[model samples]
Target: MTLSAPPVPDNDLMRYLRERGSTRNFKTDPIPDAWLEALLAAGQRAPTSSNMQVYSIVVVKDAQTKQKLAEFAGNQKHIIDSPVFLALCADLNGPALACEMHGTSFHGQTFEKGLVAAIDASLVGMTISLAAGTMGLSTVMIGAMRNKPLEVAELLGLPPRVFVVFGLCVGWPKTSPIPKPRLPMPAVVHQERYDASRLPELVEQYNRELAQYYRDQNRETPDDAWTQVISDKYSKPARQHLRQHLNTLGFGLE
Candidate 1:
């Protein structure tokens, strides 16, 4: 049997996605409460594993709290600048409560359970980003929320089995930046199998493209920009205590 492809027309959503860039600088104007609610509602519609919905979003608007969170996130000004900072968290607490209601114990200490929660959180976060884009709002995801996981959790008053996977800053853009170039399709897409033969070649090609992109933006970067940045970042152990911290936060990650 043969399958036919649906004829899809070009639309604003596709254009917005292709051209969207991480927004670091944001206007101080607050997002309307109605808009925020709509965005969160859209995010909840994201597909979840087994309808578990094992994720939660903590919305932070207090200046002092944002200030503390900014410090915890390596002094990211965007976290403090954006009118709203969203802590997208992977939560096992709700599932545990559900099990209790049923008079059964929830064994969510396994790595698979931890992974599923993270995936669920990530899906919702991406959906929120897309929804925000549609509303002419911009955003940046802060993975630095994990830089000091324990401190972050403490600041947010997270309970056991609930930890922030990342953060999202949402607001109007203060300055519009062009989207960074991504790896070519040949580098990322494989034809029904894993491919590594062209990795080196692809890396070399992407380095040139990325370096030129930086140059055009008047940013100084090495010729081997991508390779050097990644190597320097990974040369030493990164977040060496992350596993212990996660365990302390009650994510078994076994």
Candidate 2:
């Protein structure tokens, strides 16, 4: 039994929830320019930190540009196949300029501020995905772009204080991605205080649920359960170096 795509969102709020699960396979269809503008505009409406809105997006449509981005994104085939690609960046240049124009110091440009900008960028990225989904399009976020941030920055001609948090692949999905299994609310959600006593049992149940979801859909991934997948991801020693690379790209850790 192939897991069905979550039902089409029936209402505005539920529509947002149902419109999740990224799609990679895309058809050879062209996205209309007007709708493309609207999707991006919707992202602008997403909430930001103190309305600072320290985020920017680089929309890529040219085949060569997309191909270069694909190479940076670990050469994901769908990236090259997709009709659009948007690289969301955490930007501080605008604020820096604002301060300069007002002849004021921007002392808040600290490590904490960088994190806030990145969070705002991530929010914008997801909002774009949701915006695309609402317009009958598909999206797949590519975090692999961080695998080579310096190269990506040079390609995008970014200035200092601007960092690409992640890249989002947008297009018409050839096939709907099945919903990934998630831990139940009881397991993930804690009531009044932080609770961990039930964690082991909850994780066990979630692992079982994940394994069966694959069998139900007749699909196969690298691992069957959440534990296995997460373990494998953290298993790599090179993962730790990602942050050092970010520091090299103009983000001050201090």
Candidate 3:
């Protein structure tokens, strides 16, 4: 089957997005306060769940703290090398306090609300990364912070009802990796209803594309395809104990 021509980006913002890719190698150059503030402002403008804004960012600039976080995050050297490390958290403490002042009950203790906070934090994190990219900065989100959630919370001095969803390493890029290919448009985007009739074929094509990407980067190719990567990461439990940890942290999973 012939694929249609890819649409050209209509503007600089769209073009930037198309060119966006994660950068692991970072320069030690410090991002200016003004640029940081602007990037944050851009994140603040991101949509949230009913404007509840159930997220917070803890900026870690202390060398010792980054070192500790590097250890916590599976010894990813980039965590320590980046100029700024941000612990993006799902925060309900502020809303709970607000409810207290109003003599009202805060209703975000349920498991669904926990999910909401996670979603909110993730949305803001993406927004911040995009804003950073717009300013020629690079970012890599660290998912390994969940490896030791209780310790990370203790290290960051988070209050009850707040948990780090992930950490983000942001700085000037030493180099940019090629943008990874995604599943074909049809494989992901369905028109009016759900459809997967062509999924297998589309995914097979994607596997070839990704294999080529790996070969170009001189990286070891995983067997099978993206499905194998997904299965390998998720076959067993990646972080099976997080539910209990979240409960201990006051999320309660009610």
- TM per candidate comes to 0.96, 0.89, 0.93
What's the CA RMSD for each of the models? 2.1, 5.8, 3.5
Worst 10 residues of 2 by lDDT: 12-21
lDDT of 2 by residue, 1-254 (tens): 89989976578646645546778899868889998899888999999999999889998888988888888877898889988888999898878889999999875447888898899999998888887877778888888888788888888888878878898888888877677768888787899988888888888888888888887888674343788878877887754666776677667656
What does candidate 3's lDDT look like per residue over 1-254, in tens digits? Answer: 99999987587578677888888899989989988888888888889998889999999988899999999889999998999998999999878989999999988779889999999999999999988987789999999999989999999999999999999999999987579999999999999999999999999899888988888888888645688887788878678889899998889675
Runs of candidate 2 with Cα error greater than 4 angstroms are 1-16, 221-224
Q: lDDT for model 3, please.
A: 0.90
Which of candidates 1 and 3 is the stronger one according to TM-score?
Answer: 1
User: What is the TM-score of candidate 2?
Assistant: 0.89
The C-alpha lDDT values of all candidates are 0.93, 0.82, 0.90
- Backbone clashes, candidate 2: 0
Instruction: Tell me the spans in candidate 3 whose CA falls farther than 4 Å from its real position.
Output: 1-9
Ranking by lDDT: 1, 3, 2
- For candidate 1, lDDT tens digit of each residue in 1-254? 88888877768789888889999999999999999999999999999999999999999999999999999888999999999999999999889999999999889988999999999999999999999998899999999999999999988899999989999999999887599999878898999998989999999999999999999999999999899999999898988888899999999986
RMSD of 1: 2.1
